[model samples]
Target: MSKKNRQIVLASRPQGWVQESNFRLVETDVPALKDGEVLVKNIYLSLDPYMRGRMNATKSYASSVEIGQVMVGGTVGKVEASKNPQFREGDAVLGYFGWQEYGISDGKGLQKLPESKDIPLSTYLGVLGMPGLTAWVGLIEICQPKPGETVVVSAASGAVGSVVGQLAKAHDCCVVGIAGGPQKCNYIVQELGFDQAVDHRAGNLQEDLEKATPNGIDIDFENVGGEVMDTILGRLNTFARIALCGMVSQYNETQPAQFRNFGAMIASRVKMQGFLVGDYQHLWPQAQEELTSLLQAGKLKYRESIAHGVENAPKAFIGMLKGENFGKQLVKLSEE
Candidate 1:
């Protein structure tokens, strides 16, 4: 193992849109493992839109990252050294190790990841991981889409949304995706097998969504909560289920959001519920098992937008907030 560990820390808070200057990359010595501790060399660090919210001073599902602290994130790494009886050298593990080349843990939150040629390790941070779990919990557990139901997902080509769309499609539902561009929209429809896809950037969102879903939407998997959400809410069928995931569209905005169709919740009897994956940790293993089977059977697909180094993680994160990333935005910290 290298004696030095390079880490990306939050340098400052963002005033509005996140800037690269908000982060700083610094190198430090790798601390020796204490009793019952393991040293993990991070390979892939997930760059998510929620990390932008963590940069703020206010609180959310998790605590905010203070300035000078390593930015918080999910990581997949290999155990380089171990003092714990449960972990051995070269064992792959997943944990909240943040943006660093090295992480030390005593097996608190760490879970052993599978070592297999068939499934890539980076998947522990994406599809077969948190985003995939989010999709499962939101779609199957929360929304509970029935066959022949019309399901619409915002940020449809993104990591979590993509998984949600595919899961809905597998359930024999009519899946309509709302993405940002023609390319993403095309991929959502053709590549992911979504029934219909609407390009949210084309400026006629209402018309596009209306045309795509002739029947009123029954299951709304919301990822981008802004005008797209407003348009979807307006067309919700009675007793419609809405799984409120991340609101990527307003993550960078400094001001409070004013909802135009929030009343649609009552008027259309929409069941809009916001959720965090952390709330259902007990079900993650079950979710992963189902996802793995689907992936092996060639029924599910996942995409990754990778940044090559830890130093570039900030740029990748900022780009993700601006909707520049394609799928799961990840920083390739080390090679397998």
Candidate 2:
């Protein structure tokens, strides 16, 4: 591999919302593929909210990316060269290939994708991959919604939230989604079959939530932690289950914000649990199979907010943090 590879490296730890200066774009020689290794040219990169946590040098469920290291992320890439018999040139695979144009892997953590021209390769970074899997495990395993139950999801129009709401509807549950604006809320209820949607940006969130979830929430898929969480927590039914997937609202906070209504959890008997998708890796194959089937049958629908160039990734990520993205936030590096 004689070509040079360009990557976004962590230049500094963010004190709050990340700025472009925190990242440095650098060019370096592409490393050669050694024995049992493959050279992958990244086509698409996933820009998830969780990557914000990794940018900070703090202890968490996952290790933080060191300053000067390439910002870590999931990537879908095509093999450029391979020494491993299981992989060859032109084969597309998904792996933790970071924020780079190319990567060298030994194929240990790579998953070979089927050559299905019917589906867009970009879907692998969204509906058919991590976001989809997270939604599946959180809904089926954590929330365990039953027929006629009310299931509410925050960030309801996002990649994971959209899937969760659809899956809950498939299970005969009444799903309510909470998103940022009237447009996103409409997409959730009208396009995704959610029973209703509440705009968190509305002036009366608590009242809006009460109106939307008249029967009360039985399962709350927690995505944003802040005022929306406070309002939803107040409306939880007895024996409610909460799947704490993310807190994008609080991700950039320097200190933990106070939630005065958490006491409601006691009276509601709410069981709140936080989960990292990596902990449920064993079930990914099952999730992919089921989700893929849903997609093929036209039962599952997804949206992507794609930034066309790697050079624009920083702006896209910043936009996502500010609720600008309507679905899975992604950066497209190339058409390969």
Q: Which one is best on lDDT?
A: 1
Residue pair clashes in candidate 1: none
lDDT of 2 by residue, 11-106 (tens): 998888889888888999987668999999999999999989988777877899999999889999899899999998999999888888898988
Clash count, candidate 1: 0
What lDDT does model 1 reach? 0.90
Q: Where does the lowest 10-residue lDDT sum fall in candidate 2?
A: 308-317
Off by over 4 Å in 2: none
Instruction: Work out the TM-score per prediction.
Output: 0.97, 0.97
Instruction: After superposing candidate 1 on the true structure, give the runs of residues whose Cα lies further than 4 Å from its correct spot.
Output: none
lDDT, model 2: 0.90
What's the C-alpha lDDT at position 236 in model 1?
93
- The C-alpha lDDT values of all candidates are 0.90, 0.90
Task: Give the alpha carbon lDDT tens digit for every residue of 105-143 in model 1.
Answer: 999999998889989998888889889999999999899
